[model samples]
Target: MRYVTTAGVIALALGLSACGAGGNDSAAANGSPFGDCIITGEAGSSPLNLISDGVVTVKADLPSPGWYNGDTVESIKSGFDYCLLANIAHRGGAKGLNLQNSSFDGLVAGKAGSFDMALNQITITPERESVMDFSDPYYESTAGVLVKKGSTLTQSDLADSHLGVKQGTVGQMLVDKTIKPAKAPAVFPGDAEQQAAVAAGRIDAGIQDLSIVLGASVQSGGKLTVVGQIPTHESYGVMMPKGSANVVAVNKMLKEMKDDGTLDKLNSTYLTEAYGVDPTTIPVWSF
Candidate 1:
């Protein structure tokens, strides 16, 4: 339902038109299926049609720290996901970014409408594939148990603790399929609510991504801590509309980033440097 075209395409596989909208010769030479760059923008030419010509539409939950950063949606500036998208557009010859605000449940449910892609630490699963598309895995993650500092969650309450989880996340998946705690877990709209529940003693612990829990713990100034990690061993990927034409291009860009070590550098910059928590020290909590 949204417009999609290669960025900076000057001619339809020929050359720049008077209006300067077409295809990239290099892309055509490289056997790009889109034929040519049929658009023009501040960036160069590419071969894929995106949600918008000359711009990439990236769907995300505003204020997704560690993944993407902003005091608010309007203030987003830098983070792991932001840098990844910038490089993806740079490689594809797109020069613009339109960050669409949406919910995590919407993203996983394939209902976050009209964006080229979504990247909020999403994990790929076979069930989700029925309704959406996913690029090759870009990053790996595990679930962590967040508890108030000095809470007796691990020592004596493993089976009876009332857990809290962010809706539509691997944390919820773990609760439903693995943890099987004595009581039904409280599902929150987002991590902030889950963290609040834990802070208020409303839930014994909150389960979320290790990196996410670490960020929340640090921000809490020792009021919260990661008590243990669940070895979900999940890999995160970019989510797209089912059978989108952009999948090939997106995967190609991810492969290039992985091969060139750009992904690792981004991880270091945002995850390690920005969050400042090491996964190695976190104790593993087995089922």
Candidate 2:
């Protein structure tokens, strides 16, 4: 499977910044006031601090088992917080907020005044953005096909086979829309479960995030190979209540991270390491 290296990611970040600055300031300025401060549900001890009204509060929202186990969540959170602090230092103050980790349904229902922003691995879709505001994406990845080593399938050889994917994820959507396989099966298992099924010959192939699939493949001693990639162009972003002031603050921080190479570094540390891939070779996704 192809991989990305740190140097390559740094170049991509520079290229993105040169092409366009992220965040829509006009949208943020036209939105709601920044008054309330809270982080409803997050993992571990409160690693966030609010700087407003001459008060600083630290709160914790513990993550569920599934959330805490993934490298993507941790990496994104680190980059988010790092950018946030820089923004606060340069911009005077920000509304403190954190997202609660609940089921997808719980998140969609809203968490009252718990947090002003949520940083889960939320994929941006027109249907979702219609109800909630989404910051510029923090991470971009494509779907990939995982098969046993030495499989005959090439990157384009799986259009007619039975493909497996976790139900309700970008992976599933990519398989449905991009691959349009002849016999796609809905495999609603966890990442580990789906990977295990592929390894055990229960399925011809499994569709998953490139990061997760590559990470698991390395952990299994190269027993699997990613034979195909789906060009669905998925991304993860910060979900905020529509018209929140915090949007500006978050975007500011994100841009700074991009400028200083912090974003690329974080991706290298967590994602590239997990997948045993060099950060420089990660494909660039056009914004």
Candidate 3:
């Protein structure tokens, strides 16, 4: 979920310690973006050769709001990632969509060839392409600031406040490069730790993806709220196993969705209507 600046930050943050992380424009030329593969079948007419019969399996760290929207697959009624993959499953001619819970770490490094793809807010990088295949870019995101409910701290307090960051993320990089808090940030391994820290008052704030912080605010039961955002140039794509056969089909579906307004509709349905927060209305804090 972290962006590439220091490749190692991506590795440690996402629990993929075995490789470095950074962007590569040559990914498709190197066959990581399905360059060697061609569209072989019509959408929804021919079922894919999936990991399961009559099903398209997508792995993600569930319970993430603005994305998974549920603590588990059975509880998921709607979400950006869940609905997005549901569309992909339908396009692939699968009768059902299988959303599985997995560790954000293991989902990247292990389970090669065991699932169809992953849509866990992952950014494509040359180092990641070494281990996984990526569909075309689908969504762009910004950094949202999460804080304690009813807290008086504003963006003005950011300079001296104890800010927390998920270890090895673009948010951390932005905090370091842009915000430059007087106190060094408290860094944690994943969303849970950072969220917990903010809720318990150990830190003044936590910064991560807009959807991530917003989702936390929704699930926080009035204990947390998002007060501001930092615009960041980060885009996410669907991740697949290294050299996956389905990458071509996934890309085809993505192109159609983007061209036909499906992507925009989903953004409204899940991020706005479902989550009750329009990212546009959140203040863009100037640090």
Best candidate (score: TM-score): 1
| Model 2 error, position 48 (Å) | 10
lDDT of 2 by residue, 164-208 (tens): 886456777777777787885757535566777778777778886
Q: Each model's C-alpha lDDT?
A: 0.67, 0.47, 0.66
- Model 2 misplaced stretches (Cα beyond 4 Å): 1-100, 104-115, 278-287
The lDDT of model 3 is 0.66
lDDT of 2 at 5: 29
Each candidate's TM vs. the true structure? 0.82, 0.61, 0.72
* lDDT measured at residue 175 in model 3 versus the true structure, 0 to 100: 91
Q: Residue 94 in candidate 2 has what lDDT?
A: 32
Each model's backbone clash number: 13, 16, 0
Ranking by TM-score: 1, 3, 2
Show the lowest summed lDDT stretch of 10 residues, model 3.
Answer: 6-15
